[model samples]
Target: MKIQKSFAQSVGTLYLVPTPIGNLEDMTFRAVKTLQTVDLIASEDTRNTQKLLNHFEVKVPQKSLHEHNYNERIPELLDFLRDGKSIAQVSDAGMPSISDPGHELVVACIEADIPVVALPGATAGMTALIASGLLPQPFYFYGFLQRKKSSQKKELEDLRNQTATLIFYESPHRVKETLKNVAEVFGNREVVICRELTKLYEEYLRGTAEELIEYLSEHSLKGECCLLVSGATEIAEEEVFEGTLKEQVEALISEGQTSKEAIKSVAKRHNLKKQDVYKEYHEL
Candidate 1:
């Protein structure tokens, strides 16, 4: 385990800065200052990041670091950091490594004993989650699903038994199709589609998967979308409980539920007090 003191001053650091997802005002003061002070800014798209820099009047020079060039660029960035030159990494929008470039660079930096400081600003997944009208906490942030229908459905099926809220990012053109898969695999569960977040025309579409699929059938959606799906219900959880109370709880635990969650599910299924279920599951 390596401990990183971000501001050690002896060695150069890599700052993971966040940019606004849609509205430019979401950029944080610290993020701008870090960008301005860094020796270099490694951006997923130099052209896209340039507009943000121009707006904030940050004069820092930028280098391209997208998926295509990351393999070749990581070495150069390591060299820059080793030379005691701090750098800031940013994506087109939102946090640097959330469904964007920078994760690999971060790993490289860690392995090389370089300090990496991340500044929180904006993230489309969390932004959409809080307003999704779904359970906010205990959420699973699945960035993007496979483009193919079979693979997407298979992936959804694997997550069907999960009890946490699921978040996904999708292009507008594929939103309707993705919803159709959700409806078929997960049934008519409650789903929310957040579009154009933080922009003037931002919109949220809330309904059952089937309902939104039908709405999009007649309408066209613009802007990138965040799709939130409610997770497995109590009814679905009960379906897997087929044996004794202790055995049932163990089964849920084996399926990745925590001991507390397994006890709660067992209690809910049998209409027993949580204490009673917990006692039985613990063999106390």
Candidate 2:
């Protein structure tokens, strides 16, 4: 195991600065200070970040490090850090690397034994979670669902038995469809939609998925959305197995699941390792 001491570092540090999701006042003093102090600011969008820097009167040199260019940009950024030129990475809104670009760079820095410091600030998931009025602790942060209907439904099915609250970020155009998928997989559980957080027109809609879908049928939603779904009811696992592991896997495969999917389902249902289930199924 490796230990990281953020402040005590010989090389230039990488500060993950969090920006405001909506209200400009949400920008912390430390965040502003770090941006000003850093030698270079690696931003998800240079143009978008420039506006924020302009607002805060922070005039640090900016470079684009978004999803499209991160693979190529990480090396140069690491070189800067090696040269003792500090960097503060910022996304367009909220925290960098939450649902944005920065995680890869963080991983790269860690692999290279570089210090990565994260400054606490605004995040849409937690910001919506605290006010969601649902079970707060042990909640799952699942940012963004699969856009394809079948794949998205499959993803929801994988989390069908989770007892922790599920949080997801969805675009305005797709929130309704995602809610429908949640209802189909997790049933008509309580769901909350937080919209335009920290802004003047912020709004929250709380109800079961079906109820929310009925409401959305009439109104057109605007702005980014955070979807919070209540967890499944706590239930004891089945005390007995229906058949041998091999038989169970075969049953699922016969019913149309791929071998990999069947093996995964068997493993999760029996609380066994996937490799163990695969071996039993293959008699290896």
Candidate 3:
């Protein structure tokens, strides 16, 4: 076990700095000072970070460390640290390594016995959750979902029974489709859509999943979105089933129930339509 006394070591430290999500005022004093003092700043997007640096009057040199180049750049950054020159790692916005690059570099630093310092700052997931009016404690932050519909549905099926409030980051282009999938799998539960967080256009739209879907059908959304969904409430005694809908339907068929009878029974047991159960059983 290696212990890190942040300032005690002669080797350079890897500072994980969090950039503002949107509003420039969200940048913290310590974060700015860290950026100003660090020997080099590794940014996900140098062009975007340059704007932030210019605003803060931080003229520190920056190197690119994005998803595509993280593996190749890790060793180079570690070398700089070994040379007693501290480095700062920042993403396009918010904390690094949270659905962004920097996790791998952090791991490498720990293994190499280099100190890593993380400064508290903006994070879109938590920003949306606190204002979502949902249960703040016991939340599951799921950053982005599978872009494919089938994969996303399967993931939702696994999370359908989780009791924790669910938080998801989604792009504007796919938010509507994701809401429809959530409604289909998790039922029309209460949900909140937080968009353009910490910006002038920041807005929160609260409604049931179905209602949100209907609203999105009429209103086009822009910018990043955070979806906060209420957790699965206690399942009714009669509604609980032993296996998946398809499995239960097949089991009923084996117990001398006709296909139609099995489908209806499974549907009723899971609060689904008989046609849906039938279609799912046949893989249609």
Candidate 4:
């Protein structure tokens, strides 16, 4: 005997709704509909979201879902979907997944074959990135840096030669130290600093690494900051072949430098990834 599937079964959609970064007016029209219609709403913070829903007069039920509980709650959420109940997932602010906790849950929903829809909404990183006046393409988002100076320094060192724009979000207290580290690691690259975005006191500070270091010292910073730094430019191919690798290698090799030693020196001096230099040495 064949069994018939029930049409009354509910299908849940994980909508990554973005809330206002600062101004409540930034919320989109579709976001309002999705929040109001979903069977359940998931948020990073109930208190914060309550104010939003209250403002829009959305009477939907809500569940707490954030970085700490996202993994723990997904299985249960999936079970709710299998029971055929529609649901909506949202972070406390901005898009649900980016720099937020919903990424893992999104992957879980995909694995479970649940339909997911991300409603268009405000995202601080994107807002700051485009307005940052940096080369938007080929950019990287670091979110937040290691708070410790040494660890943060290492992070900057790793990206020292990254040939794209770099972005990071930081609290007011650490913005000064963070920018200083950028200057030390990447040199005098251009920086666009955004603070209290889309608010009455919104400010954008544009300057070089050296200038920002000076400016921040004198001014009182009031809001969370997003930083954009331009990346290193790729040097022309002709610049490298000008110094014969064999000649360079032979000089180091003659000075008791092993193949590894010779490769490291060349790689560091030329700002090429170490693996590329090793591959060329292996080919030789």
Query: For every model in order, what is the number of clashing pairs?
Result: 0, 0, 0, 1
> Comparing 3 and 4 by lDDT, which wins?
3
Query: Tens digits of per-residue lDDT for model 3 on 151-211?
Result: 9998998789888899999999999999999999899999999999999999999999999
Compared with the true structure, what per-residue lDDT tens digits does model 1 show for residues 171-195? Answer: 9999999999988888999999999
Judge candidate 2 at residue 280 and give its lDDT: 94
Across 1-284, the per-residue lDDT of candidate 4 in tens digits comes to 32323233246566678899999999999989888988898888988899999999999988898878877788988898767777878777788877777888878877777777777879888899898888998898888899999999989988887888998988888998999999887888899889998999999999898898899889879888888898887532333444566567667888999988888898877878768877776664
**Residue range 156-215, candidate 2, lDDT tens digits:** 988888899999999999998898889888889999999999999999999889999999
TM-score, one value per model: 0.82, 0.84, 0.84, 0.79
Error of 3 at 266 (Å): 14
Predicted structure 4, TM vs. truth: 0.79
TM-score between candidate 1 and the true structure: 0.82
Model 1, residue 157: distance off in Å is 1.0
Q: Tell me the lDDT of candidate 4.
A: 0.83
Which has the better lDDT: candidate 1, or candidate 4?
1
Which residue pairs show backbone clashes in model 1?
none
The alpha-carbon deviation from the true structure for residue 138 of candidate 3, after best TM-score superposition, in angstroms, is: 1.0
